[model samples]
Target: MNSALVRVPGTGEVSLAPADTPEPADPIAPLAAPWVGLGLSTPDGTTLARKVEKEGTEHWQQLTPARYIYKSQELTVASVFQETKGEVLSAYFGGMKFAAVGTSTPKVYRAEISSIPKGDVRALCVDWIDTVSDTEVYHHRLYLPRAEVSETEDAQWGRSQEARWGMKFSALAPPKGKTYIAVWLTDDPAVLFGAPAVTTGALDVITEDQPRGK
Candidate 1:
């Protein structure tokens, strides 16, 4: 059996409570602070951005809950235009377009990013870090196999802000298998993929402070 043991930082006390203990009154409050990392990659998960772009640097911005909604056993991802410059914007647009159209066709680099006519729906993996703590970090990963770019609204140009790009992606369930949401609480981000997507066995690895993913 796999297990994860959590101990309080700078103290000898273990973090686990008895099985009969009641749950927290407000569970959502614990996950109030979140950090999101968005990346651009091929349908097969290979990153498209060159190393010179400082690939892993994530932009900290407001993610409207109204845009990204999760309910009724479905997860929909969307976002409004936010001011960003350079490669970061490029990567984001790439991911959005890639999700909209499959990569089998060519992409046009004109003023407006457009792809060749094709019906290949690629995949987009959004890695979400919900909570970081002294002992471990909680992660929720969404793998959208049927992701596609939806319609966009016009943006008003003003001196106070630069034109921003709006993105919308729908994550439909694959023909077989369960939904593409994975949850894990671990000290290492690499092990998050091993955690279960559904509620069952979600915390099975809670005691595994140091785990190696296969």
Candidate 2:
């Protein structure tokens, strides 16, 4: 017993501890924008997409319930993005035919994308992922949803900019429900996928593995 040795309790396997092992990275290390990306949960509930932008969610209330006044409030999740197209986008937006002469109702549009045909009310979720670290991610799931789209194109005839769309959605809690927004944060991808944990190390456990800032 001259030297320190570690052994498994049940198997009785003795192992030597290495002195040169590097320290684990900081799990709560700060992150930056260049290596971050946004993802939206797909319709099939199987995967994610990079269609979403870094634009954050907006939550506000005009009056506090404690104050007891006529107050206006809305809990909404919005995604601003340059116009893009795909099966997911087409299905979600209801056939991808953007026109000013539309007479259909919002309920009709939502039904087109919703896997569950809950007319007038839908459910959606978004994922905020860190590309630099590939470790941490934020997932937001909302209930009882409604969607609105606003797009603008600036035509100066000289200066040009790409048209952008703002997807405004409001979510509400259902009856007997106390939660409106559920957020999940984790460094492991398997956890996000609802699978068992199976990874480790500085990249997985600690640091985001990003470059330093100026």
Candidate 3:
């Protein structure tokens, strides 16, 4: 069996930025400022879910439905954040205000969750890395131009376990011509299987043979 065909997120990271921040053009380029990492997450990692709703049109004279009408589509990413830092708290409790105060040895941080706003949209990205060796690695990324926290799980404080913030972000439609979500992959299986490489706005599949940092 070819190990290259198998994919595992050896290391995963979740980052967020302002909704208008430009999506990364280079598949493997390192993320820059404005993109703040949410820090470590639970071992369960992240979950990407897509749900499609459709309605079947039925005719009284026909045995089967005439057609299936597309009703709606929803894309969501859920994860349990292990860190309770300012970034994580701010994200989990949307519309909350976070601040760092004092000149003491360890700066005191606070997150005030007074209200939940209607549309707390943000640009979000999740990166997965699979390292085969020091020089050979595979990267996968999922990006959403506009997303909001749609649901959150209860945060429990216990002496036996660490506190975790669990939340789900629902992808929103971007500006008129922009895609709601984008995905990129390096060392793609399509290229390994000898399929022609095709580049489009919504998805990108890169091979090792291609020039880097394009």
Estimate every model's Cα lDDT from 0 to 1: 0.37, 0.31, 0.81
**Per-residue C-alpha lDDT of model 3 across residues 1-214, encoded as one tens digit per residue:** 2234556779988899988678877547778999999989999999999999999998889978889999999999999999988778888778576678888868876666665466678999988888867976877778888888999999999999999999999988878786556555565454455655555465555656766564
Which candidate wins on lDDT?
A: 3
Model 2 has a clash total of 0
Which of 1 and 3 is the better model by lDDT? 3
What TM-score does structure 2 among the candidates reach? 0.31
Predicted candidate 2 versus true structure: per-residue lDDT over 1-214, tens digit per residue: 1011111112110001111112113223332222112233222322212132233334375433333333344455554444343323432353343333446655233223444433233334333333323442332222122322222223232346544333444433333433333233335344333333223443332223434456
| TM-score between candidate 1 and the true structure | 0.35
For model 3, which pairs clash? none
Report residue 18 deviation for candidate 2 (angstroms). Answer: 53
Residue-wise C-alpha lDDT for candidate 1, range 48-153, written one tens digit per residue: 1211111232334743332333234544455553544333343345432223344545743333465753332334444434333565644433334454444344
Candidates in order, TM-scores: namely 0.35, 0.31, 0.80
lDDT of 2 at 9: 16
Provide the lDDT at 30 for model 1. 31
- Give the clash count for each candidate: 6, 0, 0
Pick out the ten consecutive residues of candidate 3 with the lowest summed lDDT. Answer: 182-191
Predicted candidate 2: what Cα RMSD to the true structure?
19.8
RMSD (Cα, Å) for all candidates, in order, is: 20.5, 19.8, 8.7
